[model samples]
Target: MSDTFSPRTLGILGGGQLAQMLALAAIPLGVRVVALEPDPQAGARLCAEHLCVPYTDPAGLARLAKCDAVTLEFENVPLEALDFLEGRVPVRPGRGLLAHSKHRAREKEGLRAAGAGTADFAVIEAESDLAGALAQLGGQGILKTSELGYDGKGQRRVQSDAELRAAWDDLGRVPCVLEGLVPFTREVSLGVARTASGNLAFGPLVENVHRDGILRTSVYTGGDQRAEAQAREIARAVAEAWGLEGLMTLEFFELPGGELLVNEVAPRVHNSGHLTQDGGGVSQFAAQVRAVLGLPLQGWKPPLPTAMVNVVGVDGLDGQALEPDWGAIDALPGTQIHLYHKAHRQGRKLGHVNLTAPDAETLRSRLAELERLIP
Candidate 1:
């Protein structure tokens, strides 16, 4: 691996909060970022040189190609665009992982190929296939679009043949994957960073809670010896199998019998990892930047127990009508807040707060206090 210590330019394909955080992490390392996004008001534009153009725009791709190393903030970036930039500039984690992650079917296949266990699933090509797919998965399953789905979107739960047909129709008869629901006790996610030189760093295994299929909170699980070992092994195997050059997150289901099944893979920095920013010495964004630049990777150890609470836009409350008491939140000890400056809508991720405590009891107390503060 080559050293990139001399003022390097990093290119990011999407300009959302992830890219914004990455840009902030790169500043102290003397690394500059060029973000390609259609929105001129993207959060990343606050820190990086923004190329205000669509992902597929020729001029935008050309400008991104000039960076020393490029990475994507979101998986939905056009594969063709990454293909165009592959040889022109080094795109970390590469397009192979991107292609696998961009679609649900391909992602499941990639996991099975790596010898990882996943929920039994089948493909739904058309409405006609829904009934048979449902039968194959035992009459109850989730029908998800094969591509471009996130945060509970592009998914439908069907318990009967009639419901299956309706869901297929509702999803526009697009290519989809039908996965049997697993009766799991809880959800956990692990983030791993691997460099080109094969150095690896693992973030704390976090227990996740979701509401309406969107991540609501992630608590750092520090002392679960068995679960932590298994989770780390799964993450490491997947990263090594894909030969990942940057960061990726593996979300898993913890069954009642103490088995971990792979749920999904995000081939970039993940939302569940937001706690790393304040809980530990190295944040996920910083680790990603170092990995992409071929810098040495370092392990993360949380200095205190922490929990991250996601602040979602309230239903029936317009962005203009919602006003949070920031002063009250800031007054709380060991709390750090980060608000993504974006137009708010119902169920949208507006920001997150990281609360740290000396132990688990105080952490739970802080979480309860935070719940009362959110509007």
Candidate 2:
């Protein structure tokens, strides 16, 4: 926690692009990251100094515990693993909040308790219970997995009773949460960081666009007093309520009548805030590192307007071509692309590009230009 204090090692769970980016951001600060992931080809493996075997391995937690502090890039790390290591090493955004995020029902319940708005929902544990929950929600709704679902996985839209039953089966009959469909205007997310000392910081609001459950692009819409204030107020309340001490992103639905409904909560650096790397006072990764390391939080200040584009696997495109594309993103005005160095796989997150401009209109135009250039 000292300014001159250097940690010999930082442990990370779920070594994906998020961990990789956190490691990259921590280098200048003299922090070394060790990650635990099953796949050797994971994005963070390229950078982490050590891999703690595979996650869920008791031996792995024991190994990672030798570090000064442990943090998880993904929330899916089993609560048991974290609980086992809790007293041995410091884990930021600790299990208290993460335990809730792992389940959709708990997440919604927590959001409502924090005075945040969300679509009407009910917990669905059986196929027979689906109809009643759907009826309570009225008309059509989306069924989200209770645990371990992300990027549109483990979820389905149920408009009919037949679809509800099949959707329940499709989700492997796991405990689920049913949410009434919202006629949302757009999806926006707010990224906030809270330090162990209770210092909190909020970032710019971003309008996100997702395709097939995968985030495709994020447009950094500058702080609207009403929108940003609402999001910030809600995030701060959640952090204080949960006593969260790490970076967290709150995804919200901006609905008609200017109301915002909580969509989901990500207790780490989020995909929607990728634009912060190039356009914010401090990138979300940097802020996360700062918070987890017990450093002071930075205030929210965006570079006018920013746009972030994600790179997903595409057919017939040589993976080797990514190098030149990186050059293109770098050469373009106010744009930066981060490649995850992951093995080619369909629908997997490969990397992201952050672009900024002097204004929203210019940012939009630049984003459109990059869109054509990416593919």
Candidate 3:
């Protein structure tokens, strides 16, 4: 805390949970955050100043350009908006990496170009492209829109031509990528933060479990030397290639026997990394704000090993208040809960619980109990 601090303003492009957390982290550092989002009720509204305009609003962009720097919570920011901001203010992770992460096909190409392995794939821009894409991908593949897809949406599994066609139709036949589904035993993600000056901080390679394609739990058990090393190497390569600053997360499919293939990348804070906030050390949100502002970034190692379980609402629930008993969560040993302060909806990520323990087995046992309690 000895470093000299200055009051500064940071502009954020989205007002979702990630931006909300970033605003919370910035408040302690004497930095102010302003967020642009179309939704007036966005999660970040509680923590930051809101510009309730579309991402590309000229007045909004002009106002945002006045901040000391700019960053985004999600990858779907329009390229024109970045171009506008890039000409006026500093945009962390910059246009190159954002462009790469926004499109699935382009992202995979960038990953492979950065020396990370990925699923074999081909683009399916139309129905006529489906047959050749399937044949090339070996008769079965996952069809996903090349853009604006997240949280298990806009993607489907297809093992036959009829299903592929149906899946594409279901997805509105948008520009898509048909990928050979990875055969893997585990899915994991690594989050890394890099400063504008090129110093890097890598989070642990945590194991992830998903339900219906949305992450439900992320556990940090540690001690996978092979996977850890691979994740770091790929992170370094991609950061170096794209001249990355701020945070970028690499999600990987860990094949049996410790081999890892890149699955996806998010150029901002990620859901899987939420455990970083409660691990008895500096959180990823603070690290991201530091990185983009060219401040010194502390290493990612947290004091207590921890795990997180998402608080996801079930279907048929929207506009309903989840007035759960916080006393119950507070009573649990070494447990903390984070609620997004938003209304509930089916399959929506409302918050997460972080559980800490002295060792992996104890942490896992606590995590299971926490999951059941939250549901």
Q: Evaluate all candidate structures by whole-model CA lDDT and list the values in order.
A: 0.87, 0.83, 0.86
Residue by residue across 226-344, what tens digits does model 1's lDDT show? 89889888888888888898999899999999899999999888999888899857888898998898887886647678889888887543436455567888888888999888888
Which pairs of residues collide in model 1? none
Error of 1 at 278 (Å): 0.6
**How much does candidate 3 score in TM-score?**
0.94
What residue runs in model 2 are displaced by over 4 Å at the alpha carbon?
A: 1-5, 316-331
Clashing pairs in 3: none
The local distance difference test score of model 1 is: 0.87
Q: Of the candidates numbered 2 and 3, which has the greater lDDT value? A: 3
Full candidate order by lDDT, most accurate first:
1, 3, 2
| TM-score of every candidate relative to the true structure | 0.95, 0.93, 0.94
- Residue 193 of candidate 2: its Cα lDDT? 88
Scored by Cα lDDT, where does model 3 land?
0.86
Segments of candidate 1 deviating more than 4 angstroms:
1-4, 316-320
Candidate 1 TM-score to native: 0.95
> Candidate 3: which stretches are off by over 4 Å?
1-4, 315-327
Across 235-277, the per-residue lDDT of candidate 2 in tens digits comes to 9988888788888999999998878898999999999977888
